[model samples]
Target: MHSKVLDRLLFKEDPVEKLQKETGKNVNDVHIDFNSGQTPQIPSQRYFQNSNIFINKHHRYSYMPAHTHDFIELNYMYSGHCRQYINDEPVALHAGNVILMDKDIVQKIDYVGESDILINILIKDDSILANVLNTLAQSTSLVTQFLVNASKVHAIHNNYILFDAQKNEVAQHLIDSLIIRGLGNDGSNAREVNLLLSLLLNELSHSIEAETHNFESGTDDLLQILQYIDQHFQTVSLAGIGRHFGYNSNYIGNKIKAETGFSFQSLVNRKRVSLAKQLLAETDYPIARIASEVGFSNASSLSKLFSKQIGYTPGVFRQRRHVLDVPRISRTLES
Candidate 1:
């Protein structure tokens, strides 16, 4: 299911040439950070050219050293098996198995055999996730827990979520779609990319079980709340959502705030923005129509919040190809 471009990049490119292009170093040159007695933890934003989403395939000789990223990383095992260490915990990644690792988590990839093929999908923390999670609406499962921890400062240490999709048709299809869309050189915009990613996450949430550490706690009630919000965000109120989940408004609000860092209204706004972005990118509908579709009363209201949250007016954001270029943080940690 891999694209021709992906095939060429993964198989045709010479290892030394690819390494120099990616790391800006010759094969024999040792990294200064590694030579300085510290594990090199590279930030995704820098290596990915500040793009919110980055995807690449790594071969055996291209196996990366022990490192960590400042963005969420999804390692999808397309073929063969890989041995990796996450916070020193050994993980065996078989074909069709995916591991979701959050930002700041230390990991190392051991030598991959000649037949192995693993794809790395790295997502910046604030850009696509804030909106995609709302559309996913799965707040309780192990997958949802990893996403939540990824967005927040507090993370479940030494833990990752695994999804085995070898036997699942829907999961496999979505995974393939993401890989193709992500690597294609065509004019596929960010909207389509995030949409595929959201759908992929939703599909996995339905069929796959999450593997989390003891610290990764999940609640069924939050799942109900998130699902309800996704379905009724256009018209759902705090009181109405609370009633649906058999909880009072105040109690529901507090629980949501505690679990997610977003309040009731803030969460709704995020969901609306997510929908609006999809519409803006995928359709030629008027701004007013897009606003109504995403639950906004009018275009002006939608524009106000959208600008506040995204920094660009809806029209500008769409015209710019749905790519929101937010400022990146420091890539390297101080030793």
Candidate 2:
């Protein structure tokens, strides 16, 4: 199921058309149509599989409201002009420009123009790329290493991407050609594809430093504390966790609260709630036992908390989501 932004964008009145009407550009000649499609699940453990390229025409302001996908998405605006909000900030995108958005970011597109045509690619996040990243993180690819870690957040994550239409001929040609070659099941040499990937990162990093000067700013120490929180979601007190980086427990907890707007205990409870849902839908364990499995004190507490967060009791969520709540795996959908 999709969330609120998606529901609004797909069903509500056009926001961009209102803008055009205000500016008197809607002489009734422009036609605005919002389009959407569901992409089949792609196997990301290989090079790249089942990628799609779309070119759409929308005279009205067709918005992509904020939502996070479980994969990487890149956007290139080949023609027309637009302004977009990338992770709650206003970003101007135009012809010969591109945006590389990571999996964790929640963003929406906003633009006012005659026609907006863009190229978007969704990539699997934890596929073969994770393995490649683990290797890249430990070795001489220091810049890539920096980006690999940096790209894992809900913030405007990758600041090192800029596109200049008038300059950088090789990079421009490569971008255009990759869109063409990557669309089909043929004419793409592995060597060229690999080269394109490396060079794309290189040029993106180059431009990002110059144009996207307002990059992400925050505390790295706070981030590590958050990562520790994720690591020990089912844990408590955790004296050694803070000491691993020479931070005191109280100070670490305070930092997490300050940075992420959630107390340490609240974060842990949120994690437990998430895990509880997974267990309810994906396993056959009894409610009382599932509570202990995910570190809840008892079944009553789990039920009360899960209902508050999920808007349904564990039994109800299980029945609605899993339908059968079948004990064994069933292959219901075709690949």
Candidate 3:
């Protein structure tokens, strides 16, 4: 059943490809409106009217010109291989590889043949992205830290993260699941699509072959510091991290605030709260224990900060999650 669905979706010719074949013209020439702007910026409105996640197959047999868009783009090489020039740098993508391009990045694709299947997954919703980043706050991966920092500030532009997941069966499965879900109902299953995308990103964060390109100066040191904080947030201090990185506390503290718009303590508190929420939802741990486990002094401290940041106390949040999960548990037992 999965094979049939994959074959139909991957092999079938879309309307644009049909037009290209009939007229012997590239997608750019066929769609003159795309070239109206000086740099040819693809607006979110063109493909994202009712959905924050949009999935489309890249048009084949045409040279896609250098252009920018107003949304994050994930290009998955589903089959075969193709080359693209991102920021005038050559990037070759093979089957099972995924590349995430941030907004306003100039990208030009070489002509792709019929056997080469490239899938475009465009995300335009900042709230969804924020939720993903929050869920990943405990991750010590430099890639995750880079993403968190890049999203919070505008210092990095024309940036991209490449994941050479050609050997990662898990990543490939997640990518296929995202494509299948997105292509199924035209945004009717948007919640599921977003969840799959989040899972995919989390998987990519741990990928050993992940690489980030076109980052601004000082980003590497900052990302390393952020990773250290994530790894030691329970007992991390400004002075401690400063010594570890061979810088003074004041300089490191100001840099964190400048790049992420949050003070050092604030970032640590956010990570603690993120872990507290996870434990509350998934464990039977007591509120005080959960608080201490996540680096809080006591339950009150957790509640004060949690309520301020998440608009709910730990007890209330756990109860709400329990209420939401009861029905699903009941349905499973009934079956």
User: Considering every candidate listed, which one attains the maximal TM-score?
Assistant: 1
lDDT of 2: 0.52
Between which residue pairs do clashes occur in model 3? none
Q: Which runs in model 3 stand beyond 4 Å of their true positions?
A: 28-37, 208-327, 331-335
What C-alpha lDDT, on a 0 to 100 scale, does residue 51 get in candidate 3? Answer: 70
Ranking by TM-score: 1, 3, 2
Tens-digit per-residue lDDT, 241-317, candidate 3 = 98999999999999878766778887788678767877777777778888888887888989999999879899998
Best by the lDDT measure = 3
Candidate 2 matches the true fold with a TM-score of: 0.45
What are the lDDT figures for the candidates, one per model?
Answer: 0.70, 0.52, 0.74
The CA root-mean-square deviation of candidate 1, after full C-alpha superposition on the true structure, stands at 9.0
Report the lDDT tens digits of candidate 1 across residue range 105-189. Answer: 7888876655677888878766534544555554455666556556554444445777887877787887777777676323344
Model 3 scores worst on lDDT over the 10 consecutive residues at: 326-335
When 2 and 3 are scored with TM-score, the better candidate is 3
> How many pairs collide in each candidate, listed in order?
0, 2, 0
List candidate 2 stretches off by more than 4 Å: 1-114, 117-219, 238-240, 323-335
RMSD of each: 9.0, 14.3, 6.6
| Ranking 1 against 3 by lDDT, winner | 3
